[model samples]
Target: MRFLLIEDHEDLGRSVQERLMLEGHAVDLAQTLAQAREFQQAAVYDLVLLDIMLPDGDGRVFLTSQREAGNTTPVIVMTARAAISDRVGTLDMGADDYITKPFDYAELEARCRAILRRRGGVADTRHRHADLTFDPLAGTIEVNGETRELRSRELRLLEVFLGAPGRILSKDHLCDRLFSFSEPVSDNAIEVYVGRLRKKLAGSRLRIDTMRGLGYRLSGT
Candidate 1:
């Protein structure tokens, strides 16, 4: 999943970004409300980890603006505000969940998964395409009863294709989804990852089809 992490604290933000990336999720870190808005406008995110107290302004207000603008992207607010009213206020302003500061990383990860599951209507973390089974959480792919580990990039690539089976995804769109805003990536880099993923899925029922001008699509034979 792609996530937008809006945080100001250097250490916490870096920790969260690294943790999420290690879990095979692409994350873009924004330090202030302005930066967060720019990132949010540039791409669609599966979820957002927002810190209520930002350098530029209150995160709740930014969330409120997002809601008012009809952006239904799920937001999980992280703040030191432990008061019940504070929590309620964030929820009322359209935060999908709230986590107080100094919380466990495990709890945050769990909440992210829960919210994504509910939104995606996917109870299980495993995604399937024909005879191929992909466990996003485990970062493994199984085909014909044989399981193999996937590199982080390969796993993310497969997730993108699996999410929209049989649909053509433009190179630009795929690049945006696979690489974070901060990462330097070229169209050729996307091709390299796609080639690697195709090689990995060799002999499987699922195939990646390249369209002349449209881009690529995942198809099952």
Candidate 2:
């Protein structure tokens, strides 16, 4: 899953971003409203972690604007405001969930998974493509009941491909999905990951096809 975390606090933002990445989800951290909006426009995120107190503006206003724009992307607001009214206000502004500051990472992860399940963003922890089964939480892949070990990057790339089988994915978009803003990634790097993934799927019905000057597509034989 791809997540956009809108947070300004350096320590908090970095911690959350790193934690999410370690959990096998691609995360993009935006420190300000402007940066968040730009990232939102560029990518389609499965969920958003929004901080209400931002440097430029209030997070509630931003959530309201996004809702008004018909952006139904699930949003979970994180704020220090623990008052009942504050919670109600955020929910009224279209936030799907609220987490108070100083909360545990475990709690946050649980809420995120629960919300995603409710929104149908992730029907389950396991995903299927042809005969291949992928468990994002366990970071494991199984084929015909046999387990296959894959590198972290390989798993991430395969997850993206399985999400949209038969769809063409551009190099730029794949780069965006695979790496975060802080990581330096090139087209050659993407090709390297794809090459590694291709070798792993050798006996599977799934195939990743390269479209020169276009991109790559994952299809079944």
Instruction: Give the TM-score of each candidate.
Output: 0.91, 0.88
Candidate that would win on lDDT: 1
Model 2 lDDT at residue 85: 98
**Least lDDT summed over 10 consecutive residues: which range in candidate 2?**
178-187
Query: What is the per-residue lDDT of model 2 for residues 1-221, given as tens digits with 9 covering 90 to 100?
Result: 78999999999999999988877678899999999989877888989999998999999999999999999999999999899999998999899999999999999998987887788667688877788877756667787788887877888798788768889999998888887777666659989999998988877789899999989999993
Q: Which candidate gets the maximum TM-score versus the true structure?
A: 1
**Reference-based lDDT, each prediction:** 0.89, 0.87
Model 2 per-residue lDDT at 140: 75
Residue 164, model 1: Cα distance from true site in angstroms: 2.0
